[model samples]
Target chain A: MKARIEADLPFYFGPGRELFGFYHPAPAASGAAVLLCPPLGAEQIRCHRLYRQLAHALAEAGFPVLRFDYYGTGDSAGHGRDVDWTRCLADVATAATELRARSGAQRILAFGTRLGANAALDATDAALAGVVAWDAIADGAALVGELDRMQDALKVDLNRFDQARPELDVRLEWQGFETTEHLRAQLSVVGLPALGPRTAWLVSKGSDAVSEHADRQGRSVEAIDVAPRWDDIDRLEMAILSHPLIDAARRRLREMA
Target chain B: MHEQAFRFGSSRHLVGIVGLPPVIDHGVGVVLLNAGMVYRIGPFRLHVDLARRLNALGYPTLRFDQSTIGDSGAGGKLLARPEQVVADVGEAMDLLHQQTGCRRFVLFGLCSGAQNAHSVAHADPRVVGALFLDGYGHRTLGQRLRHYLPRLMKASVWKQWITRKRAASGPRPPEPAFVVEPLPGKVVGGQLADMLARGLKLDFVYSGGVSRYFNHVRQFRECFGRLADHAGVSVSYFQESDHTYVLRGDRKRLLDHVAQWMGRHFPVTRPG
Candidate 1:
């Protein structure tokens, strides 16, 4: 396969260069940039391929894109146990500034999936032209509850092989990554902030409450049919490649630009 | 430790992260391959953790995705997947050798990655050491007995078996995209013998995740016969850990075991 004209540049940013990200520069400048906020832990992993594709698409459409790992996740410098909602928000703001500098874009739109969408909304950055919240978590407590259920189901599935296996400490972990009680407590109260006029809320068909909430705030809401099964243990290895979602986000971001 | 991300390969489309230690005490760098569709950070970031741990011990490490996976772009569509993977790994070794002055290398992988590592190690002379996690394995008589005997004693197994029999048949689940085709015992034995004869260090770790194919410590010997008895061949059976080392405790145990094995086989000669 032929390489793209604009090759992505991977580098570290943030304090002490602790945060890792890739800068997908637009071949032709649109004066706008997109910052991608990844979901935490395993969700971030499963959606990695999709995110890369999204970044490439956005860049091809003349929007420089910055896809990054929040502190204490992925190739970022901090330990997994240290990750928290507060750190994620701060990282988002830092990444926005970095993206603005790297891409020389005056307007920066943020696109986040799952919990990362929450971070994008919560982050207070003036450079942010808008935010695209895809399957954004409306309730942190509910997300935690779903994660707990998934972990329990995983344990049950594994028990088929070894019945004597001891219960994993769910409070300290969700899936395979390390988590902290502090993080869980912080996540429990997380709610999407009041939507800005430019903010677009993309939800799966079932997330009516989130859609209604966005509509009540007079923000754009698009209900997508193909929701990514990020937490499914059976399809853990399958990468999320929802063309509909990608196209929707691309179209929305183009409109914003 | 310092970690830097860059693109390698002839097209410079393949992305990788190289973890460098404060001091380079060993010439053989470790290359962590992608496990299934999981990216370079590995499932649960096992590779990043392991890379940093190994770096702390002064062994440089590189974790990258092959073409058409993760951040890496596609390779030549003309080449088969296996050939592309082997070619990608050779390019990874070339990058490490050029950047770190490491002439020798140790390849590490999980599941599909393990199979790739084995193949690459067999093909590339620069690969002086290789670690395979849940790699190739065939069911041995002892392994089958150990796996099924406990289930036979459990009433729940029989109950489930009956329940499944009574249930209506539906669509069968699609076969997994990546399956390790077990090599013939003779073929594996001959390959291991050749690698061992070249003074290559080999480590194999089988988790409880692969219990269907491999169970008990002796299964390694049962499957490979006398070749598994080689001093250079180290085998670990984590009957409690799953295929991906999902649990924090299991992952810690694995990381510890890998570090110990690497230290024992490829000691850092210079004082860090």
Candidate 2:
């Protein structure tokens, strides 16, 4: 068995706010730390176990790992409607700082899944040594459009509010979590920007549109086509790990001297 | 209701969250165990919702991961052991007793968690009641007939049988099997009898997904003999719900039912 210490605690990122996270400290100092930014809403619920497994594997491989829920997600402090893409990026930065201070690591890495990947690339700080974007959403407008399609597909009567009534917040509720109008608009404008990290890996389905966009903006990214095992609607209860994606991330982090 | 995160156990590595009501219920609190690989939050945040509802109804609840599961780190052992799970539940109970002066407890769990809760209720005298959701039990001959007979009548089954594309696909890929260990049906029945003999309240809730083994509402009675009709034992079957209660409506129904069951069987009265 691998030797590691897990601390499940909340840290104050704002004056009156606290964010919950799990800190996985490696047995020996690896001089490098990784902050895992998770996807929001139902995706976060589905991937919680896999994310923990990734953190454990990373810690066992001698890297300090910190995986946390954004302000309004998981066991964190806020409600579902309070989360936005901007605040989530700030949460990532706060997590990176905490990981560095706790692990005494000089360099940091940001790894994210889906929309979390978007946040990681957008929130690259000066201390970031590498970035791993796994099946990231390429364009926010397209994502919003897809969400609209999903809402339409549901075709069920809304509990109270309706899209026909423009006065109310045009909310989209997926698997019990709702995205308010303000957050929805913010998400509509999000896309991968040019990143500063030299070491980067982009894992996507068949194509790396986000990385290609980043390349156009002068950021080099090594893209790997690996199909994700995520089903946004269907609840996946199995404890299966994506070997290819994990292996790719492990190999990339290992190469980040 | 308020929630606070904490780590308990000798190593202080087991992580849990305590949901407390406005007033402390010093006599009894509910301890929710992990179901299969699902974390303490449960599928679709069911555990979180259930804890809040229980607390609002005056019963504090503690939901946590075992030594090597969820947010908790590995506990020197690689494979999951039932004995370890049982001991971890005891530690959670001890923590609740120390923090809020809760002496009596109600254990609640689903699937493998239900099995573990059953084992713990039989082993520990402190548990006043236990709720098992989609727990294990043997299928009767009538149950087998009711379950398999429906599949033969499905249009999709006949289509598959005629097309045989599944056969031509060269053996369909193996699904990732659920790894949780199940207690034998006889053993579970015996343990339930023992718990009831000691005056422990028990509730067995089932979903439509377990229809293969538990086809009808009366199957529990048929399988457990006279023990099923015991005053201490209660059984509920939600024929429309899945194993994990994926549907939001189903989850809400489950929460409501569990809360009502607790009110009737394991009501918490705060000590004045």
Candidate 3:
């Protein structure tokens, strides 16, 4: 239980900024290190409790984990634009280094949700260990399309303001807010399947084709819907304390042994 | 949209569920090509709900995962080829006709599946019309190459031997299971893209062009456009919904129109 808690470990990537996170070092000889990437937009907000549960679970299991913010968001470096794949991946790399140096764990893994899953899978060609995705966004194009549909649903007409290639940056009367070109560019090429080495895909619920594709690729897949755990704020604290990943750290160490 | 389960090929035709029909036949049939990896999906179960709904409206439909993608599992690394899909549509039409004596049937597809449907409906006379949900155009290797640079560069990006893959990769809780390879010169690349290029996929056809995601959206549009001109027979884009925008009602309407078009085109001879 005397797990070392490193809050906001500052790690450098490029010349731009140092990304950070809170590392919960396991109580025993550590098993491995896991960097957790949160979801995108609102889902990020909704899954905070789940991430906490995941972090505590990993810690209890004896594998220290560092769940950090990308360059700009959270307690990390920059802004939303700073959250692009380039910056996000760098931040993840930096986090892995920090975990390895501090805990001397031989293995490491990337556990990501939604948009974060893209970064994780894309990291297959990176160093460290394997990657796992939770409801990973297999189709980046779909997410962009969703944003557009949501924009339409929101009644935002970017076309009304300027006739000739109107700048989407400037807030148009109809468009609720300016849409960023950076986010768009990222989504176009965003594909987890293209990323090297297949990553495990775990659906929160329902067994569908994506998971089947995971199986085809020889990746482990499990779909467990834990009664939709995010809504229980009062239970969030307790839930985090008894997370499965955290509970399996010692067993994870035994596997390594 | 509207469809009924009926029996055709002798009760000993294929697997279990001895014939009456492997599926409900309303004389109307649609060969659905899911984007890719259909075996992992519940196509008949998912779209069957829509079929059941459509059947209530006096129409019968069949939504089967193309060869390699779903339970049909007959292709190699990819799902059925364009020509093969066309052939399947042919068989499905015959099955529908023989079973219920309805001649009219439509071929409908979504994303990459749309391309399959388009190719089949154009080549075959039986499929009078087509319905495309999130239709796509085309794709060239060069365009794909340009898009893949970021990944290539990011791969060897370790500062010495210290770092490995991202730290966040770990096993996620599993999902429930109900459950459920390759030939030479078969398509292979980025896993999903290879699968799609081989056959079966979707894109912005399901999403928007947020600047961050604009590349994906535009690339998809370009790919869809590429395939459009070649879609010989006329195909209609009904109920265009973004990634989050799948309107069941609109999809139903699209199916209704498809059935009507089939009736006008194929002219099924009613049983005497």
Candidate 3 TM-score, true structure as reference: 0.39
For model 1, the DockQ equals: 0.59
lDDT of 1 by residue, A26-110 (tens): 8898988999999988888888888988988888898999999998899999788989888888999899999989989989898
lDDT of 3 by residue, A119-190 (tens): 776654346476666667667777676656543433322111101122222221111222357767776667
The alpha-carbon deviation from the true structure for residue A38 of candidate 1, after best TM-score superposition, in angstroms, is 0.7
Query: DockQ of each candidate's interface versus the true one?
Result: 0.59, 0.22, 0.02
| Residue B224, model 3: Cα distance from true site in angstroms | 62
| Native-structure RMSD, model 3 | 21.4
What Cα-based lDDT does every candidate model obtain?
Answer: 0.84, 0.74, 0.46
**How many clashes does the backbone of model 1 have?**
0
Docking class of 3: incorrect
In model 2, state the lDDT of residue A192: 64
Model 2 clash pairs are none
Q: Which candidate is the best by lDDT?
A: 1
Write candidate 3's Cα lDDT for B1-272 as tens digits. 11222222221111000012233444544444443332211121224333443444444455544443322324323333655566555666666566556575555565455556646654565654455544443345644565456535653333212332334544334543222122111121232232234333222232231112223433543443443333222333321222212223333454465545544544444311
Q: Among all windows of ten consecutive residues in candidate 2 chain A, which has the lowest summed lDDT?
A: A157-166
Candidate 1: list runs displaced more than 4 Å.
A159-161, A164-166, A195-197, B76-78, B161-172, B175-182
In the range B1-272, model 2's lDDT, one tens digit per residue, is 36777877766768888877888858678999988777887765678778878888888889999776777765544434777777789889998887778899999989888888988898888999999998867789988887778777787556756666667666446665557657677887888889999999899998876776786778898789899789998888887666776555667799899988888876667622
